[model samples]
Target: MEEKLTDRMCPNCNDYLFYMEYNTEIPYEGNITIKTYLCKSCYYKDVSIKRHDMEKPKILKLKIRNKNDLKTIIYRSPDASIKIPEIDAEISPGIASRGYITTVEGLITGIKEKLSLMDSHDAIYIEERINNILKKNSEEITLIIDDSSGKSKINSGRAEVIEK
Candidate 1:
């Protein structure tokens, strides 16, 4: 099921083309609500997911040791935090943070894309580390997803779940 909302204005374009979609049947997130936002005027988009069951919070960890591990899929809530200590990378939720589902490789690639937008020396160095991870050159990178709301998860048997 889905609900369409269109009574909002785009923050970027200040146009009345902002829309939201609420979905109830997202895979791997049983009894969860997924909110998606889009702005037709500015081409802005975002997604957030929350569990209706209100389960306990959890910290999920996955070790990426081979190419198959990079194919692991995960759903990240807007309030979740992602960390890869191997690359000294951490992504915490902010005002503009959004949620979505993607593979481990896709997540790392997304980080690389964001880092590429920066002009600082640190960003370039981090981008190179991210490249090594993406190229499967890094040895045993650990992917951590901490979600206080327990709305994020790794959809693989290899994932380690720590209830908090």
Candidate 2:
């Protein structure tokens, strides 16, 4: 019997998939059967057969690069346990090779982290601090002003640091 499955994009060819029905003469009990489709390039059935070995995105090695000069670094793994944030895009679960971390906010977080600490000379202390920050789940760190502005400085607003 053929059953209609919800529309899903074919992971192999990145094409749209839809269910279809046909009249049968052998006498069927069910209403529908799930079918594979791709118009002229049907690869859904084959991909399903070997779906077990599909590679999952490794959060550790995933890197984000830009399309501009490519020399400016967006983000790099500062620690070993980086978590990949789930995005709504349907493009492969792969990290951005060219435009992932292209936003100003993302750039800020990336560059701040990259410039935060020294490599070997300050790894231990910075790691501890980072661990503490992560454990606290603090969204933003606020800095309070101790001394008032001399003449024309704004002293009321707080500068919050958001860790990525």
Index of the highest-lDDT prediction? 1
Write one digit per residue (lDDT tens) for candidate 1, span 1-164.
44355777777887664445464665545676656677766787766665566557899999988888888988998779999998777899887676689999999998888889989899999898777767855777999999887889898898999999
Each candidate structure's TM-score, on Cα atoms with residue i matched to residue i, is 0.70, 0.18
Local error of candidate 2 at 13, Å?
A: 28
Best by TM-score: 1
User: Scored by Cα lDDT, where does model 1 land?
Assistant: 0.80
lDDT of 2 by residue, 13-122 (tens): 76666555444321111122223444334645521111112122222122222222122322221111223232111122223211132332343344346535546545
What is each predicted model's overall lDDT from 0 to 1?
A: 0.80, 0.30
User: lDDT of candidate 2?
Assistant: 0.30
Weakest 10 consecutive residues, lDDT, candidate 1? 17-26
